[model samples]
Target: MGNKILVVDDEENIVKLVSYNLEQEGYEIITANEGKEALAKIEQENPDLMILDLMLPKVDGFDICRKVRKDGNTNNLPIIILSAKEEEIDKILGLELGADDYVTKPFSPRELIARVKAVLRRVDYTADEEKQEVLKTGAVELDLKKHQVRINDKEINLTPKEFELLSILIKHPGQVFSRDNLLGEIWDYNYHGDTRTVDVHVRRLRKKISEYSEQKHIITVRGVGYKFKED
Candidate 1:
């Protein structure tokens, strides 16, 4: 009917609940009860987005997200982690592993749908913005057309979330974007209550790109937010 979403959860109730709600929203749903099956379905169905659970059998959701992000074929697929863990570290790990959004278990169906819509909207927005071929700042260069990043002439792997976060900062050097603002612009969801998601992605982006560039351009402004240092 609409976007195809892969729901991967070991619990039959969770899968049925999510699939039922998403189906009602006009989304085509594919269900998987284990991590390995989810990966296979991802390859076979090429779903537009994935709703993953952390405590999955055989492969686990974290490993699945990591593998998906590492693969060139499905690296850009949008992911939303649906887990029971509410720990900050768990959320951070999920985001760092390339999940676009994280929803705790006992989640509201309406809110999950909202997050799905936000992520897909951002995906469409970025695709349209890719018309601006190249973006460069200091030693870092981003080719939106190619969906690639090069630092000091050496290409480095970046998850889609990381690339989008860096691209936003590099495009507007020295501008401090508040966590709320950044969450809105980058995630396409105004997660004012949980700004830590932005911080996690920034941390991952800094660590990965720091190997090539001498300067870590992701500057955190204590209570304000973050910005890219002007080259």
Candidate 2:
């Protein structure tokens, strides 16, 4: 038995296909066909990751993702949205709602599995060589071991990806990180030219941190990427 994954979809064949492929990779699979059931299983099963469909009966994937991200217990849970909606806004919305990744319908099973592995890697990543437990830059403080971030001594909630993004920039102040660099570092995989993912997370990070402090810690470098402004 490996890491348990909860697959949520109304289509029977899609569920079967995803379950078969994940199980082949030595992962334990749990399933739910509707939004309500998915939420219930999420609470009970506490899956390591979730493959969620957007259009589900009852609650819908967006609501589920929102609830999971808002809840203290499941705020850090990794989510990958599986949907047929190919619009840019939908992708942005999913990412904004805290989905780690998005895979549209007719996706390659291999690619999805690769993304799952990559997301898990990012979640489990640790820098054993770095001795610093806390990173302090201006008013922002990041506790690596505690997996926490506090601005002006007031703690603010940040998703896992947001925390990792901040950690990278804060560790190397004034160092410009290209979008590609950030995608590779934070996502642990190539996003196939989708730099918008990085943008969405950065925007959210700024919004959350802004509530606690006025200092602009993350600075966008015109045509390049972003850096931490310690001033």
Q: Which candidate gets the maximum TM-score versus the true structure?
A: 2
Per-candidate TM equals 0.94, 0.96
* Location of the lowest summed lDDT over 10 successive residues in candidate 1: 186-195
Q: Which stretches of candidate 2 lie over 4 Å from their true place?
A: 126-132
Model 1 lDDT tens row, 1-231? 999999999999998999999999999999999989999999999999999999998999999998998998898899999999989889889988888889997888998999899988877766777586898877889888777899999998886677778888888999999988888887776563478888888888898888988886889999999999978
Displacement of residue 22 (Cα, Å) in model 1 is 1.1
**Runs of candidate 1 exceeding 4 Å displacement:** none
lDDT of 2 by residue, 114-190 (tens): 99999877777743325558989778888887788888888887777888899999999999999899999988875
Q: What is the Cα-based TM-score of model 1?
A: 0.94
Candidate 1, lDDT over the whole model:
0.88
Local distance difference test, per candidate?
A: 0.88, 0.90
